[model samples]
Target: MTVEEIHGVRVLTVPEAGPAIRGGADALDLVAASFEQQAEFVVVPVGRLDPEFFTLSNGLAGEFLQKLVNYRLRVAIVGDISAHVAASNALRDFVRESNRRGQNWFLATPAELSDRLAGEVEAGPEA
Candidate 1:
């Protein structure tokens, strides 16, 4: 894992552990490690995500989201997820709710991520 701080948020490039291999414990471990290192937020830029990875059909994504909400750790997933989003209504709803709640964000590029983080910083805590 590589962590770079941008606008006070830690942008993390996590290793490709394969979607099928990740679970709730693994998500917790990653979040714990990031927090231990003093990250206010963590960004995972996955190159390719299997549709199953984001599904509520038993995977780490849902668990990780719940953990993030419970712990108040902001998270963002950056990459192309058009196919996955198209595959499941539940996942689409998850993305929408996460973004609406401001707990999680999803973007397609690094520049967009930086811009969004900057916007968040400017928007302040109430945002």
Candidate 2:
């Protein structure tokens, strides 16, 4: 992982290729990894997550997101998840709501994440 500070948001960029993150424990490991790097936010490429991560029945997505929330750290799933979203309306709604809440986001590129961070900075304390 490589850590970069974008608009004062410390972002840990996970490698595009690695062991798939499959469950809550794996999600916790990611938080630990981010803490070790002293990063406040993690940017995980979608390819690194298990296929089941996008499937709500597996509960992996909720478990993982809850872990991040409990830790008070933000995360952005970075990459294309259109296929998964297309396959499940529930997943699409989840993504939409998550984005609306602003604690986490599903972004397609590093540029989008940078834009989010920048926007948050511009929004000031209320953000």
Candidate 3:
């Protein structure tokens, strides 16, 4: 819904009120929108995603994220998923590894995401 540049990272921030994103189709739709908007990243609120997305066993997260990566678009799931992480060690690991990879990030807040992008900018495009 809203597209803007944050710390030099052009991002398409999905609106909380939009249609429910259930699977890869929805992910692809977002990818298309990102391209149209010339955004390199798609930042979706954690609440906008399905409950299964938080459960690594469900594979929805993998399926959905793969689509975005395939299109060369990075994704950041922004918001608190602390409860979800607390429940599953695999998810905890997933989130931690995702954060390090820099392609897919599980950030606690938009402010954190902004800080992340700011760091990336300072690191330069070669990073």
Candidate 4:
């Protein structure tokens, strides 16, 4: 596991798919699966996501986001998702909402993610 701080957010990079699957009990399993590496937050590169997750449905995507929120885990997905963004209004809305909440974010690049996170940290807790 690799850890770095962007603004006030601690970002951890782990092997692809490692955090997405884990075996255990139900809710505990979900939490454990989501944070096996013990990260305060994580940035999952777009390439790291499975092809099936490309479409934002009420199923997998929702479940994933729910787990992240449930665990109070902040995530920033970095990549070029122009096609995905263009395909669904709902997905666009979800992305917009996530960015606004400052919990989940979608950035074109790691540098952008770093800059935005730094700005948020400078903006202070009231933001």
Best-matching candidate per TM-score: 2
lDDT of each: 0.72, 0.90, 0.91, 0.68
Error of 4 at 96 (Å): 1.5
lDDT tens digits by residue: candidate 2, 21-114:
8878987888998889988998889999999999998899999888988888898999999999999999999999999887789999989999
Total backbone collisions for each predicted model: 0, 0, 0, 0
> On a 0 to 100 scale, what is the lDDT of residue 4 in model 3?
94
The true-versus-predicted C-alpha distance at residue 95 of model 1, in Å, is: 1.3
**lDDT for residue 23 in candidate 4, whole number 0-100:** 16
Task: State the TM-score for model 3.
Answer: 0.95
Writing each residue's lDDT as its tens digit, candidate 4 over 40-121 gives 6777677666555656663666666567777787777788988888988988998888888777788888998888877877
* Regions of model 4 farther than 4 Å from truth: 15-38
lDDT of 3: 0.91
Q: Candidate 2 vs candidate 4: which has greater lDDT? A: 2
Instruction: Rank the candidate models, highest TM-score first.
Output: 2, 3, 1, 4
**Best first by lDDT, ranked:** 3, 2, 1, 4
Comparing 2 and 3 on TM-score, the stronger one? 2
Q: Name every residue pair that clashes in candidate 1.
A: none
Positional deviation of residue 27's Cα in model 3 after best superposition, in angstroms: 0.5
Better of 1 and 4 by TM-score: 1
In model 4, how large is the Cα lDDT of residue 93? 92
* Model 3: per-residue Cα lDDT at residue 73: 93
**Top candidate when judged by lDDT against the true structure:** 3
- Report the Cα lDDT for candidate 2: 0.90
Could you estimate the TM-score for every candidate?
0.80, 0.96, 0.95, 0.77
